[model samples]
Structures are given as C-alpha cells and as structure tokens.
Target: MRIELVKGVNLNIIPSKQFKTTRIFISFIKSIESKKELAERALLANYLEMCSQNYPTQIDIARKLSQMYGASFGSSVDRRGNYQLINFSIDYIESKYLVGNEDLLSGVIEFLKEIIFNPLKVGENKNFDEETFTRQKNNTIT
Candidate 1:
C-alpha cells in the first residue's frame, strides 16, 4: 500500500440542538492478564463515570443534568477493534433554551474532569470508592 496519512479536524459549534458541547469520548487499549481483572477494571472504570466529587452520587448528577432542559449524561464500556473502551458523554440544551445557564460551559468541563481523571481502582490507598465500585461490578453483568 502507498504511504498516506490524513489530518483530522475538531469541530465546535453552538447550534440550536445543543448549546453544550461534548465533554469527551475516547477509547483505551491495554492488556489484562486475566478475565477477572478485565472484569474488575471495567467495573471500576465505569464507576468513575457515574459521579464525581462535585456530583458525589448518580442521582445527584442525574438531577443536575435533568435541570438543564433534560440534558443527558452517563458512561459505557465496550470491547471493539482490539481496544477496551470507556465512553463518557454529556448532552445539554444551549443556555438560550433556559436563559440562566451561567455555568453550562464550566459544568461540562467539570464533568469531563471527573470522567477522565477519576477511574476504577480499589484498596486502602485511595483508589475507586468501594461502594461505587461494587455497585458497578454487580450492575455490569446485567
């Protein structure tokens, strides 16, 4: 095959559909020694997506998103194209939709900070939050 490469573009917009922007969505690829570790890692990784220090719990996070004209927020895991992926997404109506969204941009950024920075890990040394980790583990199977 001929050597070829192409550059990709990042697009930003403030359109009618969404005044808020996509926080982040990228895949991760790494080796897992065993099936169990794969399961465990996936669990912890997902829990971070659930909430953050600011949000603290799933329901509180959900409520905030809901207040933003039914904005949607959450995360998911996938194994595809030889990579293990954790995807986080937040969607909210534009500030004009409600006319009082002074923090829409910052809120989106804070949520992204939580997702990429917080990940599933466990132990006494301050890893994943145990309660959230366990809940994610149980829920992942279904």
Candidate 2:
C-alpha cells in the first residue's frame, strides 16, 4: 500500500510473507536543463551515498550497516526523457529472519534518513565535503 506522507512525498510499503528481505526506495525527480546540471546532479548523488554528516567516511558507513545485520544502502541517478531521477535505496533482512528478534528495519530507516537529509558539509560554507566530492567526481568521470 502507498500513503502520502506529506505534500510532495509518498511512502510505499509492500509486504510479502514469502520474502526474507524488505526493500525501501525513495526518489527525487526533477527536470535536467543541461548536461552540466545533469553531471552535477549525478556527482551529488554519488557523494551523498558515499558519506553523510553522521557517517563521515565510507568505512564508518559500512561498519554501521554491517552492525545492522549487513543491511545494504545505495543511491543512483537515471534519466527519464528530459528529467533526471535520483534514487536512494535500502535493503535489509526482515526482523523475523534475524536472530534474537532484532529490529533492523528501524535502524535502516534512520540511517537512510540521515543519508538523505544530513549530508557531510565543508566547514561553514554549507557545501559538500571537498574530498568526497572530488573523489566521486573523478570516479564518475573515468
């Protein structure tokens, strides 16, 4: 089932008793005016997924995800006609499948929220982390 969480956002929940994992996807869509903008958007997507304000390094993020029963986090950019879409996805084993009755879903959701809403910034300029941005940009270019 899908529900409107706010004015411009929606939450979709699909339940299946036969599946062992749950997946959540959040996406942002906007028109791409030019190639430069598209490139910047793609780089931004990469940077956001790589690190956030709370998780400042790739290893830190990975370790946190590992502690949460090996949940997976990812982001990507896609083109649909004249628009660009940025998607953030999280997947984790269902609580029923985990040992000791742990609640991995809540932790995964919180981490995803942090990744989307609280990104690593450079000093007081409010810009993305320079090191992270440069790394992602170079990786994207090659």
Q: What are the Cα lDDT values of the candidates? A: 0.61, 0.86
Off by over 4 Å in 2: 1-7
lDDT of 1 by residue, 62-103 (tens): 777776557677667677655566666667655554566555
The lDDT of model 1 is 0.61
Off by over 4 Å in 1: 1-26, 29-34, 100-103, 119-124
- In terms of lDDT, the poorest run of 10 residues in model 2 is 2-11
